[model samples]
Target: MGHRFPAIVVLGWVLAAAALSLLVTPLGTVVERSSTAFLPEDSPTLQGLRVMDTAFGSGDTQSYVFVVITDDDGLGDGERRVYADLVSTLEDEPERVSEVQDYLGQPQARRSMTSKDGQATYLVVGLRSAVGSPASDEDVKWLRSAVEDLDAPPGTEVHVTGDPAMISDLTTAVNEASLKITAVSLFLLVGILWLVYRRVTTVLVSLVTIGVALLCTRGALAWAGEQGLALSTYTDAFVVAITLGAGTDYCVFLISRFREEYGNGLEPLDAVAEAVSRGGVRCSV
Candidate 1:
């Protein structure tokens, strides 16, 4: 009974961790994927990118701005020809280009918002995929090349920016950071436990308990996924923190009581039994 107390506490911790993760992670994923009443929808710029993901069956999208040089005073013949040719070229690549709306020619909102001097025009281009898509890099490269090839009046510059690429980059960075933090936290925890106990065996036992709890939590996440749950990146960290803290706390209580009895000259086995009897009662309460 004494030896089993720690195991039972660890198992309970595992079960609790698994339950919490299963309940919360999927909800987080859904919130991230769709807007709720409390949270506003993605901005129009972001919506455009999402539309590309829907249209192309790819999880990528981009928003681009193409600027062209016009006469110093206003729109000129040279600028008109350059703009027309740019539109024609973009139209030729329909698959790569999802939509192109030129302020110069389209009936878009706030037409007056285009550069009043007419020296530069804005063309909003939406890509059908995000940066992670197989053809995204190629698409960006082609856009750059096309912009370079354009016979603009002069001083024209093309700029591209959007939510899909930014979000993907941010997500990757966050994942790396989370992994580093988890690794460091685990190492520090074990080191602290070993230092406090000054016994390799005790430290190992505690670590094993933690490991079991983690596995249980991860298994729950996997099961959630199988049930069509979309987990967010934070779920793993939440599970790890909860499981480790609770498992280690339970193990510490049992181990401390056992050590106290052993110090009082009781046999190792007797001390373990007493520790379990007391710890089990406390844990149940």
Candidate 2:
């Protein structure tokens, strides 16, 4: 009965895809992208954070600083003012900032803070204990803006970079790169499918089937994660690549076999059944 209706088969797939998309779209809310996701749950860093949180009523906060250089002359008058202003700005935000250390003018600390060329020195800003431990995106944005707002002399420059900055930058980079990679992969898939099939209808059908496979795989993974599975953040990209590559290959194989069967004088529906029986066995193996 189903073999007599190929349009019905395609429509069934279309309807299934529509339903799966509804379920997967909302799963985006539960998707997590944190350091804890990448690290072992029993790792020392996680253990240390828990212990610190218990003992201190919150987790430990990190202090970040910049090694500012005014000119080639080394920690001079302008550079010293830049250092002082940085300290003052941080101190003013006592809620977010716990301490500010300026070793620029200190007699004993001056040598350590200054570079060999005497153009650079470090200004440390201690983040408050109750502040975001692994600073949130908003926190990082605020920190950057505050540092950029500081007035500096002609040769002076301020740099706010450390572990927090690096982590924030890494997260941003991963997101952007994943999107570009996915787009490029899809574009290439369509081009390759067209080259292999030649017929526009065949290529379109192949793409539709690949899309359905990806949606179903992502939806299943999202459901598993919701049910307490520890799915990694990288799983999405991995799933997309695997499903599309394998799905397109299978589609091409089956379509080619159907065409061969029809060319050998089988009826349209008979050709489909023959192709499925043959290709399905190969896929199952």
Candidate 3:
């Protein structure tokens, strides 16, 4: 199609990419970052989670995180206020935090959450959103920021971790790595391609093809996810690496084939048709 009506094909792909980024379900939305997400859908834990989400709502599900506060001197009255205040603060954000376990009044629960050294305690925070969902990740980030801003006694330190925190942190890391990997891959591919081709047009063509493939793969995955498929958060980073490597390799082969055909006195369009038709299976392999 590109060889026949290049302008129309280019315009169509441009529109497709724009629509993919703007209109489609975001790539992150369908990616699951939790360990449970890696479990089989029929796993007892996952089944229970689905049942809980369906019956009691995701807010009341078993999706929870811990906020641990510690001090070398132990949790004194001053530190108690910090914990109380932190719970109250999280409680206020109903949209982010669904349930906050307070050990302030429950002596039994307090003992359970308290460290043997009496210097640390943790809160079991039930998220208002499903695990690995965007809503849940946002909730963890907000909770972390809130913990950091709390006024605590000297030698006191606070941290957020556990199931929910793992999902949130891993998701954020995957996203950051995807962007970094893509940028670095582009830089390296451009340098290497330019060195190999020594032609600006050929270099740009290779990159353009790669960019289109990247957009299409992301779009296709998001689309499949909407149809009840889910992928790991790390898939994006892996996809970026494979797409660039394979896409560039395929382009190199096609260009080489075209040069070979055109050198034999074939016309430009004929050369492209010959390259594509003959290179199809081999380019993919």
Candidate 4:
């Protein structure tokens, strides 16, 4: 749309962008970073997993988290008490927890699970959800916070780490990194455009066009996701990059040509319309 159409069109776009941004958050609910089914069908990992499933139930069905309690001096009554309390709290949730293997009153388990110098002890927590699933991630996060909240005696350190913890932390890092990249990219885009065009109006117009396009695309993706469109967590980040790249290219072409047309004696609206027609045809090719 040209400056003529934009008398109302841009306002419509701005309003639509504001409204559609709300739908974008829900799209995050469908975006998943966890799923252990990423392996190739004939891979050795898959083969081992199949064997495990046959022998001792599906490894894919249960997630595990490790609670390691460490001390430089060695295990003590304080450490054992902390482990016992955590086990009791975790066992309260039957729906979320499948088993909590505390090394209490079991000589064999304690011997095998403890470090050689007796400096560290650990508990194996089995969760009902599959590995890398959302429920499993939540359970791991909850366990981590719960263990940290315990009043362990001095010199005892509790840590939660394992397959589920790794997945949860990785996904969290990806999301935070995506947001940082997007913000930095936008800020740099504005600075670079201002340096090139040297016109405030020009810079704003181009970004507004790109922003409107991005918001519209996000709204469409969210709708498609609700209709069963499968997308990765990286989809949002990819969309931002693609939209900025393509949108900025098109905007540059149109604005530069519009300035040329205006200098050649065309009216403002006529120049924009001509720029759009010319830019659209060439960009498509």
Candidate 5:
């Protein structure tokens, strides 16, 4: 039984890790290709613009808005110089960019640029690519840096806003948050087990068993994936929670019975065997 438990734990952990890797690899591919991760491919209103295309053709294109801040006095000589510099930069990149409308240069575009107090100027740049196109990131980075490079009038600020970049940033933040949560939960669970058992060996054994159970569960998921199952991103968390909780519960039952037998003067090995028999019967029922 002792040898069996350790072997079971090792095999389970290895299988779980393999299964998780398999499931995650395919899921990552799907997320990137299907436009379901950082940016979606299809728009409800626009017919042809996919999230994957950075260049816009016959369909509606993705837009990036640069908000330039200045004093309420409006575009003075210094402000005009800044605007000219930005315009020249945009004009030089005609191949990558379609149109650049600055409030200071294009009076018609000024309607959209004017803030409530007229302290800020907004520039709308149209890209040649569609929403999720590779060119979109480059365009956004170029525009933001260009505005920042400009010698703005005193107290001026520049900020870039758009859906594509924002969504990409959101995905990064969510992944980080999920990782932190998982790490904290694992630490807390280990601490709780240690406190409940007060024996290093007991706690370690419990963790090993639970770990094996988790591996088995993940292996099951991986097999499902191989059979063409569509797993969600949240499936990992669900499987981990169910496996760990159930496995730990089983460990506690076994350990409790073992302790009871030991108190009655049974040898350690005999107590463990008796505990396993009792725990196994109860668990199976």
Candidate 6:
């Protein structure tokens, strides 16, 4: 096999890597952390929610991002006006906001929505989508950007916090952490392989092959997802660990054997063949 079509062998791995790279975004979409994901379809809770949804048109609880407006000497004119303007802005942009519970003007609800000192009051902004949904994530991003540049009193602060916001934040955090961990793991693998092999070709080849293998595995998993395979959010993290660890171990075994065969005065191609027949088979099994 080594004597026949070496270029095809290398090109196959390269093309696999490219295909996986293209599927990365679609793969991310398939990993859902929604409340509905964990609930069984026939469960009482799911059935109840479905019934409620049919009755009320939306069983999903309205996600409320509390916008607290405050000042040093209690709610002043500027603070009140800012709160009103915020409510007006949300109301004007019907597409972005589903509802804005203007607790700012409702004196009856002041006790429940305001701080004990009367300096702080909050507005509950209802989201258009349920938490963990794609629509909910888009709304969260829009809400964040909308409030980011709001004109308010000198000391008045704005924050968007709710289930939707939290879910979006959690997803972003997990993705970032996974990438960082994967990078560190690969870096350490390369360093260790370099020290052990004492040859650039061996280290580079092993690492590149391992990377290609990992990409191929992930791409296959992504394709499964496309075909209605439901996977947990932790799938990506686990795949990264398993593929890298197993690939490195197998590559090391094969490379060590090849080195041994070459030291015995065998040619490069012959050494590879012998290494595959010995170490590669054991690694595979």
RMSD of each: 8.9, 5.2, 4.7, 4.2, 6.9, 4.9
For all candidates in order, the CA lDDT equals 0.62, 0.66, 0.78, 0.76, 0.62, 0.73
Worst 10 residues of 6 by lDDT: 32-41
TM-scores for all candidates: the values are 0.50, 0.67, 0.77, 0.77, 0.56, 0.71
Q: Between prediction 2 and prediction 6, which has the larger lDDT? A: 6
Model 2 clash tally, residue pairs: 2
> What's the true lDDT of residue 49 in model 3?
71
lDDT of model 3 at position 145? 87
Please identify which of the two predictions, 1 or 2, would achieve the higher TM-score against the true structure.
2
Per-residue lDDT over 120-156 for candidate 4, one digit per residue giving the tens place of the 0 to 100 score: 9898877776555667677887888898899899999
Worst window of 10 by summed lDDT in candidate 2: 129-138
Ten consecutive residues with minimal summed lDDT in candidate 5? 30-39
Flag regions of model 2 displaced more than 4 Å: 1-13, 23-38, 44-59, 62-70, 88-110, 123-138, 219-239, 260-285
Model 3 Cα shift for residue 2 (angstroms): 5.0
- lDDT computed for candidate 4: 0.76
Candidate 3 ranges with C-alpha deviation above 4 Å? 1-42, 48-59, 93-96, 215-239, 281-285
Checking candidate 4 for backbone clashes, the offending pairs are none
lDDT of 3 by residue, 49-158 (tens): 76876676543554778899999987898888999999889878776666777787677898888989999998878775656665666677888889889998889999
- Which ranking of candidates, highest TM-score first? 3, 4, 6, 2, 5, 1
Q: Which ten residues in a row have the lowest lDDT in candidate 3?
A: 32-41
Q: Which candidate leads the pack in lDDT? A: 3
C-alpha RMSD of candidate 1: 8.9
Kindly give the stretch of ten consecutive residues in candidate 4 with the minimal lDDT sum: 32-41
How many residue pairs collide in each prediction? 4, 2, 0, 0, 12, 0
Candidate 2 lDDT score relative to the true structure: 0.66
Question: How does candidate 3 score on lDDT?
Answer: 0.78
lDDT score for candidate 5 against the true structure: 0.62
